[model samples]
Structures are given as structure tokens and as C-alpha cells.
Target: MKKNRRRNKTKAKLTTYGEFLILLPLCHKEHQTELLEQLKSAKRPAFILGKEVPATLNTITYGQLDDFSRINQEKEDPAVKVFSILMGLSQEEVYKLNVFDVFGVINFVRSELDRINKLFASIKVAHSPEEIAAGVENLNFGTFGVIDWYAKRMGITNQDDVYSVAWIRIYTCMKNDNEKAEYEQRLNKQYVEKAKRKR
Candidate 1:
């Protein structure tokens, strides 16, 4: 009985998605300060029950948060990068998308989509949940398990839903075809300029 009890106690240290979801509202300035103080007071490496953990909205700056809000507020049109990720389109494909088209289901509902996008940016992307490619931790949608964990906590069972939101946000910031082309052009110009200088 004692061993089982101890095991149960240890399990509690691990967090769930609902715990993380709660942090969205708590990321406010006043709430954040309080949470930070609480975390500082605790100081333990392991997660504290309902207190210290990634779900605790104590670390983000207001600017980072505001950016997240804007991202969420934007319409999820085909022109939006998130839509591309949700649809599993390549960056090249996303780059060619015109915002003019009003397609079916391309646009997300205002409020609910905002809530979902804000969470992805503020928590999953910012928190380092999953890695997209090896040695590319900072890449968008990189935190795979973290997203899953968040969904589970919030009782969001649809894996596709979670992945779609995450992918879209990450895709927005991703280097699309135009950006890649521009970069490559710049590099080529630089190389030619360097060669002329050498001569």
C-alpha cells in the first residue's frame, strides 16, 4: 500500500494539458507576477503540483504575448501560413497561395481559432515541445510531445486538430518559397560581388 501511494505521489508531478490551458488566461501581467513569485518561492527542479511547471504562465514577456494574440486574431485563410501547415502543403505551395480566394473551411471561426492559436504560440512553440527535424529544435512545430500533452490536459482528443493548429502557426513563420528565393538571390549576388572584388 505504501509503495503504491508513493508511486501515485510521483505521478502527480507530471503535468496535463488542461493544466497548461489554464495558463493562457493567467499569462496576464498581474497574474504572471504572482505566479513568478510563487515559482521562485518553490525553487524545486521538479514540477510542483498546480504551481510550478510549463503550464504556469510566469515567464513570457508582454510583447511576445501580444504577438501571439495578433497571430490568433488573423483569419486562417489559404494565404495564411497556418492553413498550409494544416493542409500539409509544402512551403512552395503556400507561397503561391493568393488571399483573394474565399474557399470552403479555409477560414477559421474567430473566437475559438484565436484561443487555439494563442495556446500554440504562447505554450507549445515557445515551450520547446517537439522537434520537427533532428538538430532543429527551434524549427516550427518542433515540440511534438508537448502539443500532445497539452491537448490531453485540455481533454482535446483529436490529434489532427492539435497538429493542424501547431503546424499553421509554425508555417506562418517558416521560410516560404519567396523568402527562400530572395535569400538565394542575395547569396548569389554576394558571391558575384565578392568575385569582382577579388579580380
Candidate 2:
């Protein structure tokens, strides 16, 4: 039993560490090595003030990412946003972190942002002006667009457990249905295409 628990902790830690490694160069080529060394030296993927951090961020939904992008326009609080939304922690949990951990998180996030900002800075987004704007009357707002789908699919209910459903489970259901449909409406379009080509 003890061996199993130890193995699980190591697995979770590696998974979490890998997540950071995958998201990096979040800054410059120089900082990439620096960040890698930092994560390597740190006891990551678990215990910010002895509170176990989740191994994976599968709980986060696409909808939450959309909200994060919109609300964090200035990119002022990457640590808070990541800790809360990605980690699935509450605002109060942010208070539990020490100043050192918080600083490390901020550095990691800012490095990524710096890399992104530099890449996109010179690229001009061209917008063609619209001649005619569609009216609200033209838009059809369904009474149960989302509800009608999930009701038949996930057996989703108005309950606490319903909210706790992982996004991957929902996405898997959709992509599996897509596979059954001969890739007519792929939720994971790129993956489906690439995997098909391999066959």
C-alpha cells in the first residue's frame, strides 16, 4: 500500500512537471534552459504550502479558457488565473501559497507571455470592414441548444456532481460520436485527420 502511494505521487509529480516543460519558452530561448533547471530542482506538481496541487488540469473547460482570455486582457495576474482556473482551486487557496512559490509561478507565466508578445507584436492583423451588419432578429437563440444536446448525451443534471464532470470526458463522447459519423463533425478535427492519415 505504501509503495503504491509513493508510485502515485511520483507519477503525478512527473505529469505536472511535464505540463510546465511543454508550456515553456513562454519567454526566450535563453530562459528555456533556465526554466527547465528551475523546475528540475523544485519539488513541483505537489505541495504549495503542503497543499497537494493537481497532477493534471483536465478539469478546465474550453469555456473557462475563453473566459480567462477575456477577463485577463492586461495579463496582469497569470499566477492567480492559473492557480485558480487551471488548478481548480478557490480564491482562498491562493492565499495559502507562500511568497516564493507565487514568485516562481509569476516568472513562469510572464516568460511565456513575453515570448508571445514579441512574436505577435510585429504581425499586423488585417480586418476588412463589414458593409452590412446582421441584426439580432437574424440570430436564432435556441431555448435549449446546449441543454438538448447534453440531456441526450451526458445525462447531465442540475446538481453539484454535474458541474464536476471533466471536459475531456465530454469531449471524448463528442469525438467518439464523430468517429461513428465518419468524421463529419470532429470535435478533435486535427487529431482525427492526422490519425486517419497514419492508417
The numbered model that scores best in TM-score is 2
Candidate 1, run of 10 with poorest lDDT: 98-107
lDDT of 2 by residue, 1-199 (tens): 7786577445433443324434454546765565445444443334564566544435555345333445564754555676665555555565455433554554544454455335433332222234124343334333233334544676656533433455455445645654565544354677888999999
Off by over 4 Å in 1: 1-80, 102-111, 115-199
lDDT by candidate, in order shown: 0.40, 0.48
TM-scores of all candidate predictions against the true structure: 0.19, 0.39
C-alpha lDDT (0 to 100) for residue 165 of candidate 1: 49
lDDT tens digits, residue span 1-199, model 1? 7785466334322323234235526566764464334333332122222222232222333223333344543454322443332333454544343221211112332333555557444432222233344455544443455455446655878754554343344333332433665677689979999999999
Q: TM-score for model 1?
A: 0.19
Q: List ranges where model 2 is wrong by over 4 Å.
A: 1-45, 59-71, 86-100, 103-148, 155-163, 183-199
Provide the global lDDT of candidate 2 against the true structure.
Answer: 0.48
